[model samples]
Target: MNKLIAWIVFLSLALGGCATKVSTSFDRQADFSRYKTFCWLQGCEFTFTGPSYMNDSAVVNNLKNAIIKEMAEKGFTYDDQSPDLLLDFHVTVENRQTNVYRFEEDRFLQLDPIDQSDVYYFLEGTLIMDIADRETGQMIWRSSASRYLELNPEMTERNLRKGIGIVLKKFPPKER
Candidate 1:
């Protein structure tokens, strides 16, 4: 019974640690209804700043596609020639390390280990999106989502999609 409880507790903590964290802030005074057309900020669709693994074309494409889809679903049209809002995004990945201590009991002797601390390393990735008025060039809305990245390409892609979706979920903030 004790062993089973220990395993359950350990599993719960491990899973919860990998969950994504998202935050959003917007200019309360800005009128969201006046925005309709959108275009990428500067000459590029998106900008990335991170290690080589996260700065590849595939990552950029995935980010762009996710954002475009979200914006389109929100009744926003993409126009480079003339737009009411300019959109920009930045991606960053950093190495992180953490020390975790777990109590381990000797299966045969039922004695706890003296030292059960372990060091774990992971890659933390963050996606930041910004929306600014074209004429004023002042940011109207912004959001960011961060999570520990998986080594697998498929899982990484899934995480990216999920993060982008959550980040933009509150865009075009309701009138206050």
Candidate 2:
């Protein structure tokens, strides 16, 4: 019985640790160093050209501010006109349902209790950031991150910042 309980606890902690995942890709031919100035283009939906999801201004503002700060820290100037890079952002949220099952052994070694099964429904959010060349209008770098969201605004902002920081860490790919 103790071994079963320990196994259950270990599984629970492992599943809970599956948090945000971030991935990035960039054009190899593009000279990242040439991107000195950037300006915000309207955030896209998914196709990179579709209308943006602007249902909440507060959320949008928070994201824009975070991106600006991150870019500035990377030594990129924010320019509205004639910028070297154009930055576009997109966000999506999905409701995910997961079932967690707990098991108990019986004397027969075949019977197990199913009463510990739990269903969880939570929001998973994805944010995509694209950097494109203003002159050629070609995408140079792109990053996308997906993570579980918090209900509180403050917590949500903190998570957003953390996610963005992680995604942009590899920006301007190191010269080889």
Q: Which lDDT tens digits does candidate 2 get at residues 13-79?
A: 5468567688899999998887898887653221232125434565556666777788899999888
Residue-pair clashes, model 2:
0
- Could you tell me which 10 consecutive residues in candidate 1 have the lowest summed lDDT? 105-114
Which residue runs of candidate 2 sit more than 4 Å off their true CA positions?
1-17, 43-54, 105-116, 151-157
Taken over the whole model, the C-alpha lDDT of each candidate is 0.75, 0.70
TM-score of 1: 0.80
TM-score of each: 0.80, 0.77
Which candidate ranks first by lDDT, i.e. highest?
1
Clashing residue pairs for model 1: none
Residue 91 lDDT in model 2? Answer: 71
On the 0 to 100 scale, the lDDT of residue 30 in model 1 is 89
